[model samples]
Target: MTGKLGIGIITYNRKDILQTTISSIFRHTKTPFEFVVADDGSSDGTPDLLKQLNVPHVTGRNKGISWNRNRVLWYLKEEKGCDWILILEDDCFPSTFGWELPWIEALERYGHVNYMPEITIEIDNDITSGSGTAEDPFIAPMHQAFCVGYHAKALSYVGYLDVRFEKYGEEHVEHTQRFLRAGYGGLSQYLSPERGQLFYLRGGLDTLPSHSHGNPEIAQRNQAIHNSIRHEPLYRHPWRTDEQMFEFREEIATALTRPPVEPPSDPQLFNSIISLGGDGIVNRAIKDNFHWAGLGLFDQFLVPFHTLTAFLQHNFAGLLSTTCLYGYHDALRCRDTLTIYHNCLDKPAHVHASVEMFHEQLPALQYRFRSMIQEMDELCHKTQRVLFIRSWRDGLYYKGQHRPDHSATPDFRALTDAIAARYPELDFRIMFVNFGNAYVDDPRMIFANTRTPDDSTAEEELAGWKDLFSKHRITLLQNR
Candidate 1:
């Protein structure tokens, strides 16, 4: 196997730090390696500096750390024709204590090994370095900064750094795990104490200021990258347990599986703006309609309509229609008091007409309110429904008036109790988003109102409602 090494360094806007890193690499390492700098759309003068150095480099079209690293690897394989690649970040400065020699030795000895050096991170007076070695129990490091040998055969086996994991978290771990699962062994080497001294001056990777401090933009970029990776179909790992991670992965998978929409550069942020703006438009529309209906300006006729319309347009108008349906059901419950009031005033002889009238009108609502309630019951089932689902599903639907009081009526307790009794097998979790003094006197009023005189009192009332809606399984979320 050819042992030729290609030095691949990835950088963003840290031109000065990158310069020092390049200098250290050229100074301490006597090995004849072709240097490849992968520039990730740096606005700084780093590209100009690279041009002056006349080193073989590749500039990426977009800004992404993982993408830059992968670009370097592709460039080395395609253009440099190097069998092995020494990958390093822009800030890692190789030390003098046989830093270059040890990497070569480790790779030579361990043939086909992914060698990681003991990195000494310096922060003011504190220094952190690796402890274990190849002979001992190995704890994996996050960054692949040392040496990685690429065989022509293994080249086909390995995939790119998940471009979605653009920022700094679990990308390396995922990559290492993938290679390890494929039967590759990792190697580690200790740096000489003298060489470790130079590592202290290397200011980039130190935990003193933290990565977020050094580059806040990188942190934001990382979120998008990680989101993108999670969205990839092939990136799913079954062993992951975190709910947030799983949610992210599911969201990403959904995004990848669905056809691409020409989203604005920042889709999450853009979506947030659209949600807020859409809520405003829906609210204005509802308010205007209520004003024309002879309802006083302060009258709450538009509240429920606005809430339902905003939710439907914001979340379900496109891909999230099912989730939007859940919000419409919630909006109906919140405005039940208004519906009751309207029915009482409109038909004085028939006080019981409100529920039936609302049910009749539910079909004409923008979100298919009645049908959505059934769909949510089916999709979430009894086991998966929780109080958080109400907020999560509702919040996603509408970015307007987060006032829980506005959306939840005084009669919510009755409705919740009814739902709980009907679905004995399902666990419903509910959290009250106290909208503060905006709607009710106490912000905690929503929670207070939901509580019955005692657990048994609540249970008995719920049982009665359960008998009424026996055919439908409905879980009521309790406010904690």
Candidate 2:
């Protein structure tokens, strides 16, 4: 009770109802705590409503309920450093005075608790016959997820909502089950009607906009996924694949400690080097593999890997779009020459093995090959030069010649050419550097085919790569 409590209202496309919910919570709830309405990319004036209400909140692209809930958990618990968190759906509004105390108390006593509806059930007489106050609340084993509360201890053990539950349905069920399996007291009816205190009620005063329509197919699919994983150990966070999970965890760990690497200020213009390739460029810089001998090339990167990865992790829905490679950045922050680099390795082996696989899952690959077109056009007034590296061959991995003609990604040549023609002063150039082995042979783009270090050691090869990059930087400077 001494520690701070954070309340989060998960909402999507329900501006009017959310407004009512916020107003109701303010009026009824007596707990002294800061709150946030975690907006799941609401377009129906929800952001405007949050602004008008002056409520602190976070917004991201409309990933499903699970991801939205995870956002709240991450922000309130991890970022805001709250000791206790109470999460409620947009429709669930407080019905009782000092409704927050019991929830917070429940989180303290029982690691987790859920809001039970007023519907009567065959309750255990022994447990139901308690005082039912903040210290002793009427309890039940049944789990209802419309409203839920957790202490930091519970969250650390329970992890997060299973993201595999795409839309709705079984996500909360799976979460509660996981919590129970972790040797903790799971969901309980803290606001039992038998105790004469109803904590909260669902739905707003007026008709609300619906975003998550009940898809029978999705429900069935989610149910199946849930059933399959029911007997398994505590569910992992975020990703399904081990590789992806490890990759995400490592990236998150890096983001936690790594501050945004700032670029040296250009007095006249804002220049940034963005990597369209995955972590390759960042890894090079971090390991001191890249040559920054005298050029200070490392300081020119405005959008480093850690920064971009953190943004993408939060706004994951952007990954589904084939056009948007990068996350949202302030347009004011970017100007002048914007160099974007992408290698063939940007497309992961298992994900983008073929055009069929690439289209099906739409795996979260690094490069959105056509994003530069939009960037170039948008920054035309400020941008004077565009050095777009479509392909760069390193000796680390074998290059695959999956051209734009064969895949869903657009032709970089056609896109850049159009951009160049539209803005003659843009000085757009696409370079394909095939240093180790030449896999892609495209005439429209500039190709730098250099000798492969076939017999060199790892250290020697790394040094060679550093020198190669230095030469490229020299060329880039001359072009500028």
Candidate 3:
């Protein structure tokens, strides 16, 4: 008993590409549904084209992707009183013949359906299509609202997509999680073609929004939003008891069981202890973070930070910090803001903001601790993990004329002890890896303080890690 159906195609200045998309729907679509177009302030004669085509369209004041999509949903559900609606991006297209009815029938069968085109196969470049069975289609744990169909009844609980995602990205995954938390996630099946089959235009992401050419602040904002939604499940009704959180986690885990996100591994991957380096490295770099997530699991258990400034300040007695914009510099000089793994992402505005925010922390200020601490807090908030690894020689310090004594165990021990005093609650394991000669035969030598004289013996080096992790209730596992 499907009521009046509404099909919306959202566009934002991609008029050239969108023309083919609209034509394809008319060519292949057999379902009796109203075609509604929502334009997000397109300037390339898109509105005029829609008018000439006699398509019922609405104009927006350059809102954004989420706002434009929601506008279409609002009209279909609220204004037109449609029972079901399908929203397609201006770039998406049908690859196979008569692919529309199956998706429409899916809405009739279940309350909602997320149409997963065969793009994943091409993306992965896999051996086979791996186009899963109907009963066991690839159950996506994360949602990308590329193209989707929704039953109107599910809307009563799921509400509308969050408008906070003003630009591209983050909106799809968040909305999908919303449906899951609200219990409508189960009423959906994914539709995907066989491997090597693409149900889309030749070039999708390459055309719009300067794909990946974005400000670093956007990355930070996106990550922050993701953390909030993941940490706080805004279920229509909260879970009865704290115990129910486990049920939720288990349910989500079960939903994610198909198409394993992690590569094929041991069935008991979670139970096993994992480590990537020598005992000394693991000892100095592991931490058992007790912060709990919304789902009640340990927030972050192990994290490591091996950097030039961290090692000099925490392992050696050397003070480390960037030469202030208006401050004096002695023998050793370093960029106060040591940004790693970032290039054009850090816009000038954000970099300047951070520059102004830098302030004095310790009295002598051997190294900048505030920014690093903020970074650690963010990492802990995200992974429930923190860094304990300190490289004896990092890039900036290594480039200098002088190098610190690599075998200064007493100095290392004292600094590590002071760090422990500062963070008494961190169930800490630490290591200092010497990267003085990174490219030579010994790329990174593992450094251990003299708790035991024999550094060569595996038994002596890894003496207390078992007990330390045991106390913290962590089963350390090694992956790489």
lDDT of 2 by residue, 1-480 (tens): 388888889998888778888887888778777687778778899977876777777664565788778777876787778888988888777866777877777777777766654442334232333344445555554445667877788778878888878777778777876666664443333343112222222221122334564588989999898878766667457656643343233322322332322222432121322233322433343235322222222222233223333333443223233342332121111111221222322345344233333345344333342353345346554655544443332212323211111123334455445535565666555544431122234433444422222233446444644554454452323211
Writing each residue's lDDT as its tens digit, candidate 3 over 1-480 gives 557778888888888877777887777666677777888778989978986787777664565666667767766776678887878888777655555655555566555556554555457433222233323334443344556777788777777666555466666666665655555534222242111121121111212221232266765786576666553534332123333322222222222223212212332112112132222234232332222211111111111233322543453222233354322121122234332211111235334223223333233232333444444444334432233444332232122211232322324444455544555554444434332221211212123222221112445333434343333344333321
* Residue runs of model 3 more than 4 Å from their true location after superposition: 125-136, 186-216, 229-480
Residue 363 in model 2: lDDT: 41
Q: In angstroms, how far off is 66's CA in candidate 1?
A: 1.5
lDDT string for model 1 (1-480, tens) is: 346777778787878787777877787766788777877768888878987886666663443555566767666654567666667777666666345544444344332344334343222223234333323322333334334444433444655566555445546544544444444434323242111111111221211111331355666666555544442333333223343233222222221232322212421110000011211222232223222221121122223323433433343222212222212322322323222122112344524333455545544543443454454445335334333211111231332222322234433343344445544565553322222122233311222111111112324433422332222222222211
Off by over 4 Å in 2: 119-136, 186-212, 239-480
TM-score of 3: 0.42
Residue 68 in candidate 3 has what lDDT?
69
The prediction achieving the highest TM-score against the true structure is 2
User: Cα lDDT for residue 173, model 1?
Assistant: 46
Per-residue error (Å), model 3, residue 234: 4.3
Query: By lDDT, who's the top model here?
Result: 2
